[model samples]
Target: MRTKLSSTIFLAILACLLWASAFVGIKIGLPYTTPLQFAGIRFFISGLIILPFCSQRRDYFRLILKNWKVVFVITLLQTFVHYSLFYTGISMVPGALGAIVVGSGPVFVAIVAHFSMPDDKMSLKKAGVILLGLTGVVLVSLERGSLSGEGKLILVGIALLILTNINSGFTNIIVAKDKDKVPPLVLSSASMIVGGLMLFLFSIPIEGLHFSAKPFEYYAALAWLSFLSAAAFSIWFTLLKRPGVKVSDLNMWKFIIPVFGAIFAWILLPDEHPDVLSIAGMIITGSSLFLLNYLNRKKIVR
Candidate 1:
């Protein structure tokens, strides 16, 4: 049991760290292409990247067909609606604001699961832990400096980001509820392919055919983003399907994203540097995770 618990924690952290790295990659790639088109290509390639591992199962295509309805729903919610709002919102707001909003995702997911899942209902302890994590996120984001921008546009962007969180919560519930019917690889691959294709086609009309000759760094960023997306989503899907895993509890791990995101920014982006607030935020966030695990182990919260 200890071994299994350790493995789950390890995998969850691995997925979150992989996702965090996308912050640097996206920043690098966005200058060369439109947001939707870049995201589309990244996810489309991500689906293809997972294909070989999936091919090991001879009946993979058949499973995807059988689970097409759920796949379609997931594609719409997870990729289409989620990223559409995400990219649009992030573009409108400051990056620090975007990071805080994205970091708050787990809170929304917890609320959604509380109402949707019988066994995953919220508790005082869980709510406290989640808020504590969000506080850490806010501190980390504020380290970048105060927001100085158009108020109305920032509000609108924030609203869109909040909606993305709600959409994500619903998507996660669907995945958890349907975990038994669809294999993780099939669900992830099919949804990413179909949804990514839709985004790419949609972008061509609105964003226009803007992909042009670019430096080696752009391609490198794209390649890294694609690979990380494939691996992270695959790991996440498998973990979500594990027996005894609760949506809210599992999602709390996402609080790690911004912590690692800050670290990655400091390391890779020359403009970024470490500071006291980020370190404090990291400590607070880590404490929340520890509190959550302690509560779970003590059966202090359900």
Candidate 2:
């Protein structure tokens, strides 16, 4: 039991670290690559990496054919729409702010799951926790100056990010509900391939098949994002398969990404550190996330 618990904790920590590093990686790579090009390459590479690990090609194809509708919806929400908006938002907003906004994903997921899944019923306790988590997100967003209209375009970028989070929640609930019916490795790989192809198609019009970055930074970012996607999603899906792990529990760790993003900005950008008010805001957000997690855990155990 102790060993199993330790392993779960390790995987959770690994998930957090992988997610946190993505913000830093994106910040490092964005200067050299356009958002659409960057997302396309990352998804393409991720699909390639995941292709080999799929258990059976024939079975995978059958599954995709049989479940094309659901698969398409998941791909659109999880990969196509989520990445397009998220990358665009990341490109426009500060990395820390983007992380904070993305961190609100669990709140959206809980709400969606409550309405969509009979097994995932909503409780007053869980609802309260979700509210707390949202409070944290709002605080973090405000601290990051995401609430202010830095510019009209940046404000639009923030709205895009909120939409991205909603899509993330949709994807998570979809996977959690269906992971037992479908093979996760196959689903993950196929989604990436289809989604990457779709993004490639879309990019032709918006980004025009451009590849104009120095070999070092551009390829480096692609590599980082691909690896991050593969590692993070694998562990995330694995955890979702575990019984009794509420979506609200996941929100507790969300704040870590923003904290890491802040650290990354300080080290890499040097000029984007939070002001005193921002620091205070981060504290409030962090506390709220903690409270949400605590309340959810207590409810789960009782």
Candidate 3:
């Protein structure tokens, strides 16, 4: 049991790290491609990479046709709406700011999971840890200055990022409910394919394809982002399949995203630099995850 738990924890951390780097990757790629177009390409390649891993590969289309509605709903909320807004939001918002906004994903997930999932009900201790995490996130985000009429576009992007979190929360519940029926790899890859195609089709009129894998850095970003999605989604969905696991519980790990995002952005982006407070915030954020698990474990012991 300890070994399994440790492995899961390791995978969780790896998933967080890859996801955190996505902020830098998107920033790197945005110069070469528009937001939706960028997302489409990223996921299209990602889906192709993971599609072969589905267990029932022979019955894939039949499975998809049978489960088409579920696929549509999941991809619509999880992939299409969530990421379309996310890519757009991350495009306009500064990488650090974008990371902070999306880092609030756990708060949204925990709240929804508490109400919607009986076994995942929230306790006062859980609530307090959540608040602590949010406090840390808020501290990180305060670096973003006040909004102005001239900065309305940034505000719009911020709003999209906020909505993106909510959309993600709802989809987590949906995926939790359907985890048993659908194979995780199949679900991840299929939704990615359909969702990527949607973004690709939409981008045709708004932002015509200007894809070029030229310049090694640009190609590397695209390739790495694609691998990140495939690997992270596979790891995440695999863990979500375990008995007694809760989406809210898994989501606490998301706080690590902004922490690593800050570090990676500081490393990759020339404009951003980390400070004492951001480091402090990262420490606080990391503590909150342990706090959450400790509280939950204590509850179980009782």
Maximum-lDDT candidate: 1
Model 3 spans with C-alpha error above 4 angstroms:
1-4, 91-97, 142-155, 211-213
Order of candidate numbers by lDDT, starting with the best: 1, 3, 2
lDDT for each of the candidates?
A: 0.89, 0.69, 0.80
Candidates by TM-score, descending order: 1, 3, 2
Kindly report which residue stretches of model 2 are placed more than 4 angstroms away from their true locations once superposed.
1-10, 88-100, 134-147, 150-158, 272-302
TM-score per candidate, in order? 0.96, 0.81, 0.91
Task: Give the clashing residue pairs of candidate 2, or none.
Answer: none
Between candidates 1 and 2, name the one with more favorable TM-score: 1
Task: State the displacement of the C-alpha of residue 218, model 2, in Å, after optimal TM-score superposition.
Answer: 2.4
Q: Model 3: per-residue lDDT, tens digit, 192-277? A: 88888898898899888785556777888999999999989878877877766778878888888777777887888898876677
Q: Supply the TM-score for candidate 3.
A: 0.91
Cα displacement (Å) at residue 204, model 3? 1.4
Question: In candidate 1, how many Å is residue 132 off?
Answer: 0.9
lDDT of 2 at 231: 74
Worst 10 residues of 3 by lDDT: 141-150
User: Which candidate, 2 or 3, would have the higher lDDT against the true structure?
Assistant: 3
- How displaced is residue 158 in candidate 3, in Å? 3.5
User: What would the C-alpha RMSD of candidate 1 be, to one decimal place?
Assistant: 1.7
